[model samples]
Target chain A: MKTFFTTGKGICIVGIGIGITAALLQKLGNPPNMGVCVACFVRDITGALGFHRAGVVQYIRPEIIGFVLGAFASALISKEYRPRTGSAPIVRFLLGFFAMIGALVFLGCPWRALLRLAGGDGNALLGLAGLVLGIGIGLYFIKSGFNLGRSQKTYFSVGLVMPVIAVGLLLLLITRPELKTGALFLSTKGPGALHAPLLISLAAGLLIGFFAQKTRFCTMGAVRDAMLIRDFHLMKGVIGLLAGAFLTNLIVQQFNPGFTGQPAAHSVHFWNFAGMLLAGLAFALAGGCPGRQLFMSGEGDGDAAVFVCGMVAGAAFAHNFAIAASPKGIGPLTPLFVGIGLVTCVVIGFTMRKKI
Target chain B: MMPDRIDARGLSCPQPVVMTRNKMDTSKSCSFEVLVDSGAARDNICRMATGMGWDVQVTEDADECILVLSKK
Candidate 1:
């Protein structure tokens, strides 16, 4: 029969996996510990489309599209497509928006933070610690009857929104709109500007999405489950992903161990921690990470779709307003925005909690 | 008479197992292959295969893995 393990195994596995994914990403020609970064890539995509003029960090990552479409396809084939909605939708959106902001400030999400550590960036340690603290705070709220309300079953069309949006983005990607004639946006330079070939990127995204959905693989959920239920079943998958990537990286000879001048990384320790702290807390409070949220959104969660949209908007805002950080350091407005986000998260946490 | 294939590549864990269960009921002499890229996926697939009374063999590739299962 089916058996469940303790959370420790899962955590250790995730640690090892992060290390592995770091090496693999480097091997695959991705910046160290950046095999897949949701926030950064989105930001890069934003910049590529001329959302902001930030250079030196623009590239369209196939992994992003792969994550959602993969999940979409998997959920469909496996019959896990249960469309649902109505769970403090606006609040979740705001959380996603701020979570993106925080991640941009740190220049990575929790996943990237771990990868950064694996790639020898000490500054990532601060971000990781901040993530833990943020999650810890969220746990306190969760323990104290904090909830964002319950989600209810909704129409099938509601669930299709995420996948549809992803497909739209893909089509636009292929069509390549011309701005002079006034069409959809596209990045020309910087991190947003960089992209792997379209087909390769889409295929990768589809594959990962399928696997993740089938396994119910979720990094944030893995950590949250360990902390809350003391369970590790989900955690093992995270570990496996990391290990797979790491082994691949080693085979490809991309292991670089140390903290300074890592590609697409910065040295600001405090913000790294603080930024992830905000993201972790938001994720914990929202009940999923950015990646997980994308999967959920794809599987017919209108609320999650809202959150995903929030992330998109947040990315736009981060860049448009210069609140996002760069390799040089935290952007001027990032700290203030993060502060506001934390306060807002706490306020929502307290106000929306179910009284059970 | 229909040979069933479970393309579980990119699927995480319990998902492949769950889908396998769903797929097994639809076919006789079920021959299935689960695709994955991680050891955990392989492990879970094998465990489920055994529990379901299916014979399983695992094969690995550079960035992909396959778990072939047949009802015993």
Candidate 2:
């Protein structure tokens, strides 16, 4: 069960498993295609922490916590836990920050983009296109000599930071402590209010975390590889995800296709494209997608830890600044933030190059 | 003649393979060497190059891998 399955077929199986699990989660009461949205869950966690006062978006999700702990356990079991750090960590943090901003602007991550498509949400097509373009731009930078530099071996304890935090969060979720400071918020009437059973969410997250870690499942990497090398191994995994999710959705009779009135999604085509463009570029720059970052953090990469923290912080900032989108439309400052994120990503892409 | 060398150390997976593919895309340069630091990169390059009708010979040197791809 805890084996490193990095082969093409192995990754495809993992993808299908993730897709089915996510569909089931949605049916069980997650926010639509948000069954496994890394970005949205991080955003919800920030709200629960009282980082932003978004009433309808506050909840400590067990799935997020499970993702970290599960990957940590998997890496430990597989003897692949390599505690390492020091490769432009600050840059990675900023990349993750902008990545969250972009995801919220689009109202989802690449995973959600795929899940949304599988759920028969037509808007996901634009987001997927934007993701491809974004990765393409990032690949251009990569081809023109961009590197995050090399990381060094670090002490074992350093890598355990994210897992410790995960455990702490899980405890908070379980205890549901009533702090005097009005923390540990939960939404009574929004996407944050909807969730699958705690055990189920946690189990699905654990399975996803374990498999993703073993296979190195990354949505951005899938698109990048397909485009850059004309190799479709990772792309096969993406196809598997879509197929699995679609099949599950059909079985549940939850397939609904249209541009308008999609759950937790907006019809603003421009922002959808630009938002994911920024997110995709950020993930590419950071060397992994959001889920991959969490998995790496579990395995003891301090840089990945920093990136994950940046994402959490960015979620807070997004909601606080009113830059995150809602079903109604784009946030007022979304264009500003998305534009800034795009420019920042481009600058990072251009400036962080090693001499070829 | 010394084969063209592309040092992909520190770059993530598929980048190594992508760069190697770029080199192969040019008809004039059929043989090249890639310096990658991870087993994943080495394996990916081997897998991709082998699929592209190129032979990959991997040699290890001090925390890095040298993947030499040749068409002839």
Each candidate's chain B TM-score?
0.76, 0.86
- Proportion of native contacts found in each model? 0.00, 0.38
Q: After best superposition, candidate 1 residue A354: deviation in angstroms?
A: 2.1
What TM-score should be assigned to candidate 1?
0.76
TM-score of each: 0.76, 0.92
DockQ computed for model 2 against the true two-chain complex using alpha carbons: 0.34
Structure candidate 2, residue pairs in collision: none
lDDT, each prediction: 0.69, 0.86
**Residue lDDT tens for model 1, B8-62:** 5433323444456556777666587766643445655665567568898877765
Per-prediction DockQ = 0.03, 0.34
Error of 2 at A327 (Å): 0.8
Tally clashing residue pairs in candidate 2: 0
Evaluate residue A54 in candidate 2 and report its C-alpha lDDT on the 0 to 100 scale.
89
